[model samples]
Structures are given as structure tokens and as C-alpha cells.
Target: MPAVTSAPADSQRPDTKPRRRVGRPAAAVLDQDGITAAALQLIQKSGYDGFTMAALARTLNVAPSALYNHVSSKRDVLVLVQDHLTSLVDVSAFESEPWERAVRDWAWSYRDVFSKHTPLIPVIAVLPVTDAPKTLAMYEAVSAGFSRAGFPQERIISAIVAFESFIFGSAYDVTAPADIFDSGSMAATTPHFTSAVARLAEQGFESQADVAFSLGLKALIAGLGGFRA
Candidate 1:
């Protein structure tokens, strides 16, 4: 071998070490939908108490700092989640049906949506509808229905709030156990209540909660109809 120059010591040795990347691996392209989906997954897996920005970042395989680049705070993530959930409520009935019928269908759909995401109820209930476009859109549709029904501008929000309160309560009630009203040891002390419970079942109510919700919703629709001009 004529003048075979030895290779550099670094190159001569086997390349055992992995090449270092130039900077932090680029995080997946974060967006409102991706962030909201991750946050929802965290909530579903760990619930509200366990969900956090850090948890969401980990779920997305990104640093917490990277998560902040998209959502400023947990509330921001929640607003996205709320908007997604609210969009599922059926507002199409407003297009063709009477306002009362539209409200009934929308209320039932809304209650069902939140019932499955019960932990979100409190968070979404208190959050301002500002900046939540889907939530606002749903409200807009509902408000227009009320307006077409001749509800006064001043009373529209109050009526909507009242219906929401009832819907929220019914959503929570869905999680109650079948025996939630069972009066085991106190059965003897409360004849009227116990008898009523028995009568509720005897009358073929699907569930105590369901019956209560139906009764209350019917009354609320009728009562709110009174506000129509």
C-alpha cells in the first residue's frame, strides 16, 4: 500500500454514538383542534382534577412550553372543548319547528352531551361565552328561535339561562344511581316519600331522574312559552 495515510482518529473508530439533533425535535403541528382533542383525552382518562397543561403536553409528546405556544391556559383549552361539545347539540330544529319544540329537542341534546362529560359542566357553565365561537353560534341559533317566537330582547337571555340551569341539573342527575332515592333504614320514617318512590316505579317511569326531568322540562317549556309575545 503506497502511502496509505491513516484516517482521522474520530473517523477511524466505529460510529457508536448517535448523532445529536440540531435542536429540540419539532413538535407536531399544534392547532386548536389537536390541542382540544388532547385535552379532552386527558380529561376522559384522568378527569378534571388530573388534567393539566403538563399532562396534555405529555399526551401530545411535546414540552409544556410548546403547549403554551398554542393555548395560553387551561381555560383556553376548556373553551375549545366546550365549543366542541356545544356544537353537537341539535339546533336544526330551530330552522323549521315551533320554538317550543325546537327548545325541547335542543335541551335534550344539550343535556345528553354534558351528561357524558359531567366534569366539564362546572367549567363550561361558568366560563364566558366570549371567544367561544361555536358556543356563541349555538346561542345565536337559540336566541333567533326565541326572537322569532316573539320573546322580548331583555328576557331572551334569562329564559335561556333558566333552561340551561334545568338542563345542567338533569345532566348531573343522569349519573345518579338507580337507588339514589332508596330510603333503607329511614323508609319507615318517610311514608310519603317512600310511597311516592314506589308509585313512580309502579307508574312505569323509566327512571326516577328521567321522570323528574321530563316533568320539569315540560313545565319549563310551557312556562317559557308564556313569555312569547
Candidate 2:
């Protein structure tokens, strides 16, 4: 039989590996733009009720401390998201177009953008105009157009608020069900409403929401213009 050598005993082996360093782990590069994009994605997916700092942190694959390095709180992130979305509204019309046309452009574009993000409406409706620079800038542009058109300063905000109320509700309407007015077997008893729904359907192939929105928006523009000095 051949002689064999025994390996070193477990406790007798030398420790050759270096210990790992304790420092910040590798993470995604974060900034306002990245945070806003991630926050918007998260909000679009889970909505406000499901949005949380910890949830956002997980979405970004970073620790909560890493997220805090940017935004101070959830509300800060919301203001960022709000400003970012508002920046997308076509306020350019306010620069070169007449007040009525500017209002129409702004209203239609604002509705279209928010219609896709209706989940943000509730939060935006109650949100203060402060801390959101882009949003404030949009208001400034629109207000300037209104002022040029002779709107009294005192009533400018009221007129804007009225348009916003209609716009937000219309955004929700854009997402309403196609058969929401079907009425089913109960239609026989609700003749007036049933007939109206039928007439609306026969009007055109354009989206019912679009038709109603256009009608309402025209009425709003003409009606709100009455506020002009």
C-alpha cells in the first residue's frame, strides 16, 4: 500500500482571504429626473394609495436612505411629479395665440395629458400651487393670456379653477366605460335618459367623451370669457 499525506486540519489552516470592506453598496445613479421618472412609474402602477417611500425605494433598488438623499419626503416627490407632468401641457399657445385660442389649446392638451393619468387628478386638485415651479409657470402663462384678454385679476383664479374642475372631471369621463349608460332592462322605465344616450350614440363615431368635452369646453370658453373686464 502507498503512503498518503493528510490535509491540514480545519482549525490548523491559514486564513489567506482579506475581509470585505464596510461601505456604501453599489446602487443606481439617482437624481431629480430619475427619481421623478421612477415615482411616476410607481404611481401609475400602484396609484397614490399604494405609494410609499419604502415602496419607491424598492422600485429603485436602493435603500430608503439613498432615496432621502434626493427628495425629503413623499410629498416632495409628488410635487416633483406634478411639476413634471404640468410641464407637458402645451402652454406655448399662451405665448403666440389669442386668449380664446390659447385657452382652447391649453384646455384640450391639459385634458388629454391628464386623461392618461387620471389617478393624479385627486392629488393635484387639492395640491397647493406653491413648491411646484413648472405648474406655477403654467399658471403664470395662462394668467397672462387671460389678463391680456381683459380678465380682472380678482376673477382670473376663479375662471382657471372652473376650467380645471371641468377638465379633471372630463379626464375621468375619458376613462368611463363605453356601456356605462347601457341601463340594461331598466332602460324601458328611463325613456328620456335612454333616448338621449341613443341620440348621443347616433351623433358620430368620434369618442362620446370627446364630443361632450368639446361641447362643454366651447361653452366654458364662451361663458368664462364673460368674466373678462
Candidate 3:
């Protein structure tokens, strides 16, 4: 047999590069935006009860351990979502308008944002702003507005808290059915209440909730005057 030269060693081969590994592409690196977006979708579709580290990881196509690299826990993801929601609130009016007007605008914006994420209200309401830079920044702007509007330093937080409580409740109300207060057979026994309900319809407002929210918000804003320095 003719001498058979062995093929050159693989490492010494000419015009040959290492075999390109053909398999699934690497998973995209997880980042805060991707995490926040996935979390929001999961919450919207499944509610808070369905949100979990494992679920989040699955949604991101990664192991649960991978999530810990970016977020310490589910609560950390919540903080991201909360900060994003807060950023949507229109606080710009504070710069040009009177404090009351600015607050009114901000309240409407705040209520609108939270109404869509009602399930998160309780979580965010109690969440501390310690590590949430955007949340802290929102408070700083509102605080400065309140300060300029003559709110006492000691009472600024209280005023903000009170306003937030009303905003949150109003947000929930936005999701209520039009006949949520319908007393049915009991309407006959509660004459005053039944009459009020009818009168609300007679008023020709586009939305009962909108009308109620507007009336209550105006009253609340006016009442906040008591907190001003």
C-alpha cells in the first residue's frame, strides 16, 4: 500500500478554525428593563399570588438562581415595577403651576397609573424607598414642591401620605362596576341612598366614578390647605 500520510494534527491544520459550536444561542443577559417588563406582564396576567422567583425565572428562560444575580428577591422586582409606575406620574406641573394645580395633575396621573396595577397597590404602598432611586427622586420633587408651596417640613410626608391614600382608593374605585352600589330590593328601604344614586345618573356625567373622583379629589386638595404652613 502507498504510504498514507496521517492527516495533520487538528491544532496544526491549515485554513481551519475551531469547529463552530452549533447549538442553541446563549441566553440573552438579563437586565433590569427586561426583568421589570417580564415581572409586570406576569403580575398583570397572573396577579400577585402567581408571581414567584421561579415563575419569573421561567418567564425569562433562566434558572431561578440567575434572577438573584440582578434582584435579591421578588420584592426587589416589585420595587422596580413600582418605580416605573411612579415615573409615569406627571409631576412636571409642579415646576410651573401653583402647588395645588400641580398636585391635582399629579394625583390624576398617579390614580390612572395605579388603577391598571391595582393588585400592586398594597405592596407598593408599604414598600420603603430605601434602595429605589426613582421612588426617592419622585418624593424629592414632590417634597420640594410642597416646601415651595409652604408646607411645613414636619408635615410634608404626612400630606403626601394622605394624598396617596385617597389616590389609591380612587384608583380601586375606577375598576368598580357602574351598579356597584345598587341596593336592589334594599333600595326601597334606603330612600336617601337610592335617590342619590338616581341623581348621579341624572347628572349626565360620562362616568360615575370619574364624577365621584373629581368631586372627592377637589375636596381633598382643598382640605390639604390645612397642612400648608
TM-scores for the candidates = 0.86, 0.88, 0.89
Query: Model 1: residues >4 Å from true position, as ranges?
Result: 1-27
Arrange candidates, best lDDT first: 2, 1, 3
Candidate 1 shows a clash count of: 0
Model 3 poorest ten-residue lDDT run: 15-24
lDDT of 3 by residue, 64-145 (tens): 8888999998889999998898888888888889998999899999999999999999989999888888888889989999
* Clash totals, every prediction: 0, 0, 0
lDDT of each: 0.91, 0.91, 0.90
Residue-level lDDT tens digits of model 1 in 5-80: 8877975788888988897556587888999888888898898999988899999988889889888998889999
- Steric clash count of candidate 3: 0
Tens-digit lDDT string for candidate 2 (121-188): 99988988788989999999998988999999999999999999999999999999999899899999
Highest TM-score against the true fold, candidate: 3
| TM-score, prediction 1 | 0.86
Spell out the clash pairs found in candidate 1: none
TM-score of 2: 0.88
